[model samples]
Target: MSAAAIESPVPESVLKVEKQNKGTVDALYKGLSDGGDMGKVAKLIASDLEWWFHGPPRCQHMMRMLTGESSHTKFRFEPRCIEVVGDCVIAEGWEGAQVYWVHVWTLKDNVITQFREYFNTWLTVKDISPHGCEIRHENHNHTLWRSHPGDLFKRSLPGLILGI
Candidate 1:
């Protein structure tokens, strides 16, 4: 199924949270791209930011952007898909065929507190909630977003071959 088709019905309250989170993420990206008010970007991100990276060590593009080591003109991050799952926002984008990225931003009180970056790697985000005594089960898990099949194959092939 397509990424957009994975969403299940959600309450209005949840939708409101998603909308607010979307706006925060959008503003962050816009500010980064425009090279505009970093104070605004700083406001969106928490001081004690938790960051994780997957794929090559050299592919820390987002960290570089955040640190002012690289400009958007050099490496722009324009997410083609953005979705909210629980308290997290997932943004996916690609640059040509060789570079695919997924950013997972976890927010608390509308400020991004955690970031996980995946470069040239396929990602699937699932929401798992408790059901009575069970902490996780197939029925309790809901897929929120998935990398496109075409993109997944292209990005995952090398890793699969190398058993990475």
Candidate 2:
């Protein structure tokens, strides 16, 4: 069976959340790219926001971009794909083969409270349930999304092998 056919349908509520999350993420990127509307960007994120990074020290591109330490021209974060899994909005992108990035934004009341950035690494989002664990069966972990390279490398063999 086809993958789409095998997968269950997404609930309407989830779709609505995904759309709203996508819009928020898009607006943040647009504000950064325009180099104006810093107020709008500020409104989207929380005052005491927490951020985490898992990559090279020099690859703190998102933090630098949001903090005005780096200009849009220096490193633009145009997300190739944006997905909402539960309360997190995941955005993944890449700049050629060298740089791959994934940004996980957690929002509450439409304001981003936490940001997790992954650079030059593959990411897989899964939903684990402790309640599903039984005597013999392992805890259920349903995969929500996976990071993928841009169209340029998608069709290549190495990209397929690496699944990035």
Candidate 3:
């Protein structure tokens, strides 16, 4: 027998990758759920990481809109903990108000390297190097403020009167 034992590399990583992938999914989901902090996310994601979703024009557009001198907020499907491989994670889940997004992620040196995402709300990022992260909501609905519809005006009148 040789000094090195024979081993199939892919299977070796399966369990670990799945766990990492689950953690990744959970981290993003917690951020997207709103009412949470984005900084926690920055801490979780490795600097050289990129996330992508290919649905909801808002997925990308909103990200830009919300990004600021302080970019905060994140959104993604509530993924199903499906499979894992060393440095790779696989999951299926919903994105947007009602859509599906499937993804796989690879990590090296505790930093994310490649991300394979499928669906309409897709984004590709590289050299992530997150200094920090923030969390907020993805409001994908008709603007309530634009029309100033009767209901909204009614809702505002009370606040206006109260100077609130």
Candidate 4:
């Protein structure tokens, strides 16, 4: 009924990974759900924080947005898992979320510093900017999710290996 009354956003896929990943998913869930000290979490971030981006939704930007320290944004993330591989965490969540998108986070030194995101491309453009430009491209089409396509686990593996 109310925000506080609502359940946490952690997903089942993540729970499965928590057992093998040294509580990776669980620790992350605690950090995200409780809004704990992310500075300590920075140790998990991979050095080669990567993403498919030219601007905005980059990992640093996303962290700032998530940590509620960014001046540019006014929304907070309520994360839920789509999957996990090694150290890479892939999730579909809300950003104050009016829509769902898959975010893949790479952990290095115990902190998250790099990431890639996939969502309804239409929503991506809409949320980032109403007027699309050369730099801005529509990514999430919903067809993939609707059609049962793509290997999120395989996709996340490269980054996870790189991170570890």
Q: For this target, which candidate reaches the highest lDDT against the unseen true structure?
A: 1
Misplaced by over 4 Å in model 2 are 1-14, 131-141, 151-164
RMSD of each: 6.6, 6.7, 17.6, 16.0
Which lDDT tens digits does candidate 4 get at residues 14-98? 5444444535544555555465546544444454555543223543445564445763233334455444444555555543323
Supply every candidate's count of residue pairs whose N, Cα or C atoms clash at under 3 angstroms: 0, 0, 25, 18
**Per-residue alpha-carbon lDDT of model 1 for 42-133, expressed as tens digits?**
89999999998888988897898787787656778898888776677878888676788888898878999999888787776654444332
Per-residue lDDT, model 2, residue 29, is 83
104 in model 4: Cα distance from truth in Å?
Answer: 1.5
CA lDDT, every prediction?
0.73, 0.72, 0.42, 0.43
lDDT of 2 by residue, 22-53 (tens): 78988998887786567888889998989988
Query: Candidate 3 regions off by >4 Å?
Result: 1-21, 50-76, 95-98, 120-164
Q: What is the lDDT of residue 49 in candidate 2?
A: 87
Highest TM-score against the true fold, candidate: 1
Error of 2 at 17 (Å): 3.1
Q: What's model 4's TM-score? A: 0.42
TM-score of predicted structure 1? 0.78
User: Runs in model 4 with CA error above 4 Å?
Assistant: 1-22, 54-61, 66-73, 85-88, 95-97, 106-114, 122-164
